[model samples]
Target chain A: MASPQTKRQKSSKDVPYELIYWPGLPGRGEHIRLALEEAGAEYSDTAFSGDSAVQTVLGYISDTNLGDALNPPVLAPPILKHGELIINQTPNILLYLGQRLGLVGDKADEDAVFKVNELTLSALDGLSNEPHDCHHPIATGSYYEDQMDEAKKKSSDYIKNRLPKFLGYFERVLKGEASKSEWLYGSQLTYADLVLFQCVDGVKHAFPKAVARMGKSGDYENVFKLYRAVQERPNIKAYLASERRQKYGMGIYRHYPELDEE
Target chain B: MASPQTKRQKSSKDVPYELIYWPGLPGRGEHIRLALEEAGAEYSDTAFSGDSAVQTVLGYISDTNLGDALNPPVLAPPILKHGELIINQTPNILLYLGQRLGLVGDKADEDAVFKVNELTLSALDGLSNEPHDCHHPIATGSYYEDQMDEAKKKSSDYIKNRLPKFLGYFERVLKGEASKSEWLYGSQLTYADLVLFQCVDGVKHAFPKAVARMGKSGDYENVFKLYRAVQERPNIKAYLASERRQKYGMGIYRHYPELDEE
Candidate 1:
């Protein structure tokens, strides 16, 4: 989509959006990339720059880097730079992009916009944030090995309680009246579905045996159904097969055999 | 403040806003309550409903409670009910209330709105959510005593690293050009300032010694300055003194002598 507002532009270009995040690993940036990719919107990914982009991402978050008059300092990536606006925070970026890319409903439909944002926030919290905590229960800066015992406890508790709580919640959302279609929101697919898809995919990757057991139990039928539906979307399918969709590694969602169900 | 939109109204009201959250403690719900109180808008707080309100909050999130077609199922508390809308997620509720209550900015100023929301999210992340995780590092459902060792390590790391990082970040924002006024956003007080104030207050309550040392060291000059400013605001001052402003207890921000600085 062409840049709509003049005030937002520092300069015009073939692509207006630039995503500055850590190199490799889907991490949180995957949520932003999914929204952009599903919309077929061309944008720059700093991850494509390889090693050099690591410092670029760090610079934005560095204590010394005081953001300009308009934008405040970025705490962490994925930071989206569209012209003069340097916005961070995963859900905030998705909210901004959702409005522009039509991932949310029309501009006038404030209900859909906020509702999509609400669901997006919930998925990011319950699925993305909680899963990350399982591997790094004690501290973010510390190594996973240092907190292995706590990680095991966290991972087990997550599988038994938090995981099912979130999955079942989404399952309920899908079966609810608002989701008249196969999607989580109204008839159309929004960024929320894409987010739910990525988080579920990461969870399954992290704990394959447990997720498979839950799948077989027929508890989250619609949640898995939505996940598969998002995967098969024309744009998303192509993007997932492409190099643009990064792999899961030692990132937010990591696989540890001991932490998983045997 | 009157309810502005006709579509939002289920019926006319003396108090248009109803806050449904866990009773007794000033948890996440305090963020929404601060905005309503600052705006001098009338709101119905379920906390005042005594022991009975706990079940009402639980009812909203109950597995069997399938929300109406317009509103989806509420996964957690701090749910805001305004006429036909029942919005959850602290930041999302703040976003909704900010616009209506004029705690953000003028309706046309989308820039301020999103910027404010972005900052609010960051504060909620670094300050509120992270601290909650400190005590419950392993699992939210688990007792603090069960994870006391992990909590100590997390709290120590938080005090040494995360606390300074967040405090310093906000301090820079206050020193930045955008904050010509004392508030985090533009000159006037926004919901962000209220959020920052509440989070900082909670942090202080949780870690008195660490925060006192940081204060005496002359770091976070502007952050604490803004915090004091918010506290002194007429409406805020009244709210803080009143019984409506709940105490910090075993909620998100807790005080444990063992968790504090030695």
Candidate 2:
């Protein structure tokens, strides 16, 4: 049952990888933060305090030699430094960290993690797109107010249909996992649970009634419990206590109570 | 001066990796195609010819043994199988393929690949979202006809502004290459080149005028020329010549001349 490249560090494995993300708003950074905290991997959030590193990362993205697959690569956060590997993409980063941290469970556990990760990601994507839609309800190039009328309509559909459906799916998954009752997967606190918790947290912030009727999520009690569980982890507690974690803002989870209407 | 783990075929060289993607419509499959082509490794594209395999794959996504990481992760095509590892997500799949295919360049190259991948993907994201917009127009949740008025406005901006901006960036990168005039990185053809070609092809199908205005793309003439060159490659040519390449009806690119707006 040997997998490829399953080697351990022969050198000093003391230091964790450095994560370079924008210093503000947990927006996307929180996903990585949750995984790292859960892994308790020795890592530092470089530029989590100042704007200098954030600018540098963005700049490097446009400049090839400086290190950008493409400027802004358009999305840069949760950069994973595994020994030497620097991986990006929240799911990709989480998957890597999960495998190494043992947060990724057995075969079935891994599958659940991947499914939930993808599913939650779809919800997140839908949510982010909705935000953008609100701004450019009429067109992506125009100002929000110009498209305010259209935004009202798109935002209305999102509130009424998409939000509840996405949240409800999670509620169901969590409920289905009721037998396990504590984690998204089997027993342990895997990255999938962390990500799902983040999604629910983000959505709850963005849509209260939608998520509320989405139920107490009492059916998937363990999943909700795991959400709280992530916060309790020592490294997470420290990271949360630190200034690194960004609060949700207009970026990802804007508090638009009107959009969450039943 | 060698990078650690630079050696190949170190493990799990037994099972050849299988890439299951649509037969046609470059769409996201191009990302996977480029990664493998760059690696110069031999692989198979399953369900490439028959419709049944693709249907099975779609079904596979819902009922995955890998659970969440299962089939066609997130309604996109192009799935990769490496021994026990099955991955989806264009960027995630490409990253994994690049790692195995030996297409990932040096540290700086790796960083550039990631940034470019992210940026390019966001652009593609814009394209997909906009494509949906063409249908939805005024509101994302409403019927296409319902928002036809808004769809026209949104479509106009996407055509005139977004297309050029995105395509122009590619033009800049192609023209910005330091060495080769035929590829995106080093002296060799990287996955980026392949993706650009497919994107160009997709855009041409979706919006001919904007791409034509993109004109010669002399900036990254290599990237531009490489598009034609890669299309003529033995495998690609052969693939296109066959049935696995898919017809133009479904997926990312569609012929809505009205949306393109001459």
Q: Name the top TM-score candidate.
A: 1
Q: Tens-digit lDDT track for model 2 on A122-191?
A: 5456555555565456655555567767766777777676665544455445544322546544555667
Q: Which ten residues in a row have the lowest lDDT in candidate 2 chain B?
A: B63-72
Ten contiguous residues minimizing lDDT sum, candidate 1 chain B:
B6-15
Q: lDDT per model, in order?
A: 0.87, 0.58
Where does candidate 2 stray beyond 4 Å? A1-24, A40-124, A127-142, A168-181, A185-187, A217-223, A241-243, B1-58, B61-87, B95-123, B126-143, B168-181, B185-187, B190-192, B217-222
Candidate 2 C-alpha error for residue A117, in Å: 7.0
Mind listing the fnat for each candidate?
0.52, 0.13
DockQ of 2: 0.17
Q: On residues A1-262, what C-alpha lDDT tens digit does candidate 1 reach at each position?
A: 4345543452432356999989889999999999999999879999999779998998898888777877777778999988677888899999888888889854444577767888999999989998898999888899999999989999999999999999999988888887768888777899999999999999999999999999989999999999999999999999999988888998999999999987
In the range B73-187, model 1's lDDT, one tens digit per residue, is 7789899888777778999999888887888854454567768888999999999999998898888998999999999999999999899989999988887777768888676
Measured against the true structure, the TM-scores of the candidates, in listed sequence, are 0.95, 0.72
Worst 10 residues of 2 chain A by lDDT: A65-74
> What residue runs in model 1 are displaced by over 4 Å at the alpha carbon?
A1-15, A106-108, B1-15, B106-108
lDDT of 1 at B13: 28
Q: Rate residue B137 of model 1 by lDDT.
A: 89
